[model samples]
Target: MSDTGLHPGLVRPRPQRRRARSRTYSATVRTLGPLALLVLWWAASATGLLTPDVLASPAEVLRAIGELWGNGQLPDALTTSLTRSALGLLIGLAAGLVLGITTGFTRLGDELLDSSIQTLRTIPFLSLVPLFMVWFGINETAKILLIAVATTFPMYVSTSSGVRSTDPELIEAMRSFGMGRLALVREVVLPGALPSLLAGLRLSMTLSVIALIAAEEINATAGIGYLMSQAQSYARTDILAVCILVYGLLGLTADVVVRLLERLLMPWRTPQGATR
Candidate 1:
């Protein structure tokens, strides 16, 4: 017996049951939007409202993907693009970390470097293409440097902001406890700034992918961008569609990787309705 005349056993749904229902509902709602768009796209293509010349149908894109995969072009391009992005990201991350820590931790460093970095950040990356081509001669060096440059600013800004956002009172307390500068930074500043750092990493990864597209356009002999250039020359709408889809997928994958990193690194940030 319970309030409202219900049996104790049925007084309320189990928490697990409620959580499961919530997750299921959320997933269904999330999937519906994309599914509806896909259906509409198929219908338009089927009804001749959308022409293959304008935009290839989803079926044609899928077939094109299979063709590329079977011929080994897709795998080779994917590997090359991934390698370039990874290398550029690593270099950019290292440079950003050093600059961010230097400017964030010391007033002298900030006064000397932050203004210049901020001014450089204001310049659009595309405008650097001509200079990079001239300096690096459209080689792998130019392409990698372009991606590295594109990814660096986001990480620098995020890291600087994150480090500066650390609680001053907590820092003072640690100082009073006889912590050295290196120890204080290692334990107090970095941990507190971890969320921001991870956010920066995520942004950097996304920028790396975007930069990859532009970098590959520099007289590229391989990679998705090269495939896109070839497809454009041959008027292969299906191949163009495949390239666009691959870029979208790469972006999606980067986002997913960051989310997983957040979950793993920030265990305290539990999802709503999670079992904690």
Candidate 2:
């Protein structure tokens, strides 16, 4: 014992242990806030402070959702809304990535394209809805295009910024090794820009959801927005509440999926204090 080189008291706890403790604490705080809000909501409803015509109680909302689910209405509406959002998001993401990469990587591309994109971006995307409706009609085409346009700007901005911010030193080092343009981009530029690109994806997903909701409200015969419109006309507060909850859940779910994808694709990125 006397020959021991170090004291046990001098040892530090493992980092994973510390991280686990912090994660548990943060999770508790997150749960507590939502739990408190739910309690307040239940209390207000039980006390009859919230009028049925304006706000439905949690129980009423639950029953309404159950009825809709049992009748297959909720599932059908969800499918329509989700399909439009997914298709629009894919189209937007592809276009944005190509344009961003071209402009970020070449002077000629930037000169020819960046100014036009910037000018268009300055004009509010939503303001084009009336024009889109006239051009595409109030059909699925208009709705999908509206969501796509709304989703594109964030991706373009973020990806361009990310690619441009990549280290010149890394580029030089890769060039010194006689790396081809494709290899340099694949190994250096894309890896370095991934974080920003993923952030943009998350933002685009959120905007797509919002734009889809608004687009559907215009003349939708099927989808959650249409359900809400019908519920409003009938003063069906329970159904309205259910629709609101579903919209929120969809947005939250999309954000979570994007974050998970980010973590998977960028495992080398530090994990602490990442935003929602």
List of clashing residue pairs for candidate 1: none
Estimate candidate 2's alpha-carbon lDDT, on a 0 to 1 scale. 0.87
Superposition error at 24 for model 1 (Å) = 4.4
Query: Which candidate wins on lDDT?
Result: 1
Per-residue lDDT of model 1, residues 143-173, tens digit only = 9999999999999998899989999999999
* Candidate 2 regions with alpha-carbon error over 4 angstroms: 1-25, 274-276
If scored against the real structure, what TM-score would every candidate get? Answer: 0.88, 0.88
- The per-model lDDT (C-alpha) reads 0.90, 0.87
Q: For candidate 2, lDDT tens digit of each residue in 170-242?
A: 8999899999888887889888899989989999999988988888966999999999999999999999999
Clashing pairs in 2: none
